[model samples]
Target: MFPTLLIVDDEQPILHSLEGLLSDEGFNVLTAPNGYECLKTIDAEHPDLVLLDIWMPGLDGIETLREIKKSHPGIPVIMISGHGTIDTAVTATKYGAFSFIEKPISIDKVIVAINNALNFRKLEEENIFLRTRMIAKNAIDGSSGPILALKQQIIAAAPTEAGILITGENGTGKELAARTIHQFSTHSESPLITVNCAAIPEALFESELFGHEKGAFEGATAKHIGRFELADGGTLFFNEIGDMNLANQGKLLQVIEEKRFCRLGGSRVLDVNVRIVAATNKDLRQEIEAGRFREDLYFRLNGVPLHMPPLRERLEDLPLLVERFTQSWCKSAESQPKSFTPEALETLANHDWPGNVRELKNLVERLLITVNKETIDLSDLPMPYRTPDVQVPADGLDELAGISDFKEAKAAFEREYIKRRLAECGNDVSATAKSLGVSKSHITKLIKP
Candidate 1:
């Protein structure tokens, strides 16, 4: 687990001396006589750090440093020089050198600089990893055609300045879509401010959208910044925007259009630059028709439209979603991971998920916490979720009645029996076959396309 260091210098004495000293100090060291060899060694070894001399014969340190940065910017490079200047050091720093050291090299200083650069690199790597994990955590989880199309649309629209309107049913992930859009948008560095239009009181709507000065109102004890100001240079997500009253809608529309608003009891107009992303479970078109929402505001916010599909429409993604929720819950709780039996998954797939993804996540977490077993089964599900066990329901019988051929009817019944047995045994084909007193190949053949 020793860190590898690559030393690039024209002086063989310097290289040999540093190699011996560094090797004794517990570093896996590689020496290159010139810049060309340095680049080659880097490509071959991918060393953790580089020490480059400014005065090399061919392909001098500056040019080599540029090429190294262009190809492997993450590798920390410390520049060393016998004839050094402020300008040279500044130029190296501009070119992404981690540190610069004067020659008549002190091993103590070299070790200290190397340790600092490695620590810095480690922190940068950890930061990148955490950021990647954060982005993945907020990512939309599904592979259904609708979900894929929606993701593409978000990618296409996220970088632009145009406002986005996300519409979907309750628990259909409108808020999640908004957050994902913000995460991918150009203004990702800034905070994504969320305002629940339905939850905000009408009396304080203006104050919430635009800041109020100290003593502006009875409860205003100090200066308060509003959501719009907080969202400047970032995204402002209006959840359930369709539920915003007409009075508040007009005020919002004004700020969005003018890009400037004055705070309550403050005369100074603050110009703001914010990407607007709005979401609602209710149909805005219907709301506009019924005079509950403003048509002007709808047009302003609907520069781009995105829709989240309900869970029932993407039933094929249920298993993946279940796994994501299960792993997330298990990780957060520091508990042993649990899995769903195929029968349990089948029962879940059968139910029309009225509450969509949120409901499914809640159900999975509840089962993990409540059901004590590792494998969730069909019988683990409550009534209404598990498909009824009645022998050939009247509707199913009527459908089968159309197939008058005896062989066809027998094949249909056999297929259903095989499917049921497969689910019961958690889709373990061999286990299903053993239980049915049939060979594994026979079960596989029966289920093959």
Candidate 2:
């Protein structure tokens, strides 16, 4: 694709001459007669580079450069002047001009400057793409049923202006999920402001969320920009939002529903276009039943629901999760990557992971730093995971690959053994248990749910 340049000058002859020269040099050229036309062209076309004249009618070059920096900060502008000076060039640079060129512009200098500006823009775009990609992958790693479902929900909800409620146990990566959604959303270009509702004091909840004007109350010495204003044109991640006090929930609901809010002790109503993504470990339904949470606010926030299952339920994915954590920790710590033995991985799967993925990641980090061994084994496992809770009769090492107490391994073996006996003697629970020399309840327990 050819690089597009917008040439802005009051002189029609210079504009036409430069346009033709740049077009001949394999470029798409656009011309604007003055600052007004320049700004309009920039808004409509979003050119790769701008050649702005210092002596334009109405808004001059320096003033125009400041506005450009404010609105389209990524686009580079080169300033041109008939009477260019060191001081004038310095002033233009301060206003965000990329380069300063004297009039009687040499096409050689113009070409060099334009090429540099375009290259910088291309590099900047590549950096953004790489950054967003890394943030998404590093934030969450999984391919379990629950994780797959959550990913699909993010893909569907990201493009819209819908609010999302993320519910899960503590340390289940709620904050990362919010960031992942924002990274893929239409609001990816803007910032994602997070508010920790549980940490904020009840007395300051309103000011913290909707800003506070000067002298709004005691200790209000200066005006403050709230989370909503800072997240304008972006995402507002309300971390632990269910913990916010009941009274403040109404105020938040009003502004969120209306898309407009007033600062404390201020008459002017400020507008914001922000997508809200709230997360909590608490069960909002139970809170509503107990009258501790407001139903109206819950309904407002839960436009789409995403639940992250606690890691125990997905024991099948433990080895993959552990491997990811170990690799990430080693890479960050500048050490050789560590490996886990089959028995060690099986040890992890057998235990109840009450802390979920976050706990497993922390454990991996701990093990990586403290244990210098290339391969971590079952013997290196923490105390509780070392027990042989599920004993295998005629067990081969491969079949028992470490997870025994998860019920499936032991239950499957027992159910098949009993079925073999029942087929020989005819299906009878009492007869099978007695013949197998086990209690009837024991035989009943082995039956698959």
Candidate 3:
């Protein structure tokens, strides 16, 4: 679709000329004779770009520009004037005007300015889209009780400036939880700087946290901004924060308390304004007891503690999680959709997912890649995931043989299969449905209430 442009000027001749020229230049043009009409046109049409004369009678160009910015900040406006001055241009720019062109407006210059403004708006739109997608991708998936509670906690804590500490087993999505929190926080539009506490060497911890000036150390050729400085007005996430050494922990505590630190080899102290979010799989209480972690630091960082549940605790969500992974993998690979058989899902549900959701996602991707068929069966599962099929006793088989009708015999076998599966799964209806690759209602209907 062609971009729409609104031209606002007191002079009728200028509007008529520009409207014809812009229309011929492949634009949808809307004309307004003055500032009052311009604001009305904007309210009605929501044009992509506006060209307004600076010296209009009522509401004036500067006033109209201010109103436009207040109401629709995304729309770009270019100021036009017959008697332009540096002061006027600066004022227009201060009020968020995209560009300023003097009167006897050159059509070429107007078109160029219009194109640049539109491109800038397009880039801004794309950035908003990408950020939204990033947030969705990092969102924690599952409707289990534990997951719902975690989500509520995140929502409550995210808008505040308080510190957050996320604790969970490895691969339980600690980092993912941090990203989701930051994306929802007040500083969502700002940077989220991450520092892996366990990865940095002991000697360089201060330099890494408080930055370093040139000639600070042997390899410090130029000044370097540390994670704290980079995350100003945003967030600083520390991964494996429990692994930080005792010596560095003291320095960290002082900085957190003081909110100011001097860069290495620099005497001037820089004040920091950053929200802190840390995650660890280790139990901080145990570490503190062992004298490895500082008790004070733990209390400081644990303002709003959140725990991510391990996958085995939410087995009822497995089928949904599996389907989500399958769809994601299929879309990325540009391949045909794949699904797991009921028996295969049951086998997966039985396994103790020590590695949590991450492990399950990895296994799903591996299966989709290796299993060529659209329907992945239990036999396709690797040795560790597979389980023995239900076997019928000879007497039970004889009883089935007594049913002469094929439909009756089939129904008898299905009932027996579901009963044995249910027993094996400790009578979990959800697990039974997953294993059978059928709805829970289907399984419930076959079983005696």
Clashing pairs in 2: none
- Which ten-residue region of model 2 has the weakest summed lDDT? 389-398
Q: Which ten contiguous residues of candidate 1 have the minimum total lDDT?
A: 390-399
- TM-score of the candidate numbered 1? 0.75
Look at candidate 2 and tell me the lDDT of residue 154.
Answer: 81
Candidate 2, 34-125: lDDT as tens digits: 88888898999999889999988899988888888999999999999999999999999988898999989999999999989888888999
Question: Please, what is the TM-score per model?
Answer: 0.75, 0.63, 0.75
lDDT by residue (32-80, candidate 1, tens digit) is: 9999999999999999999999999989999999999999999999999
- The models' CA-based lDDT, in order, is 0.90, 0.85, 0.90
**Model 1: CA > 4 A from native:** 11-29, 80-94, 99-116, 258-262, 267-271, 334-337, 387-449
- Against the hidden true structure, what lDDT does model 3 obtain? 0.90
- For candidate 3, the 10 contiguous residues with the lowest summed lDDT are 387-396
Q: What TM-score number comes out for model 3?
A: 0.75
**Per-residue lDDT of model 3, residues 279-383, tens digit only:** 999999999999999999999999999999999999988998999999999999999999998978988999899999999999999878755558887756876
Maximum-lDDT candidate: 3
Root-mean-square deviation (CA) per prediction: 10.5, 15.2, 10.2
Runs of candidate 2 with Cα error greater than 4 angstroms are 1-113, 388-449
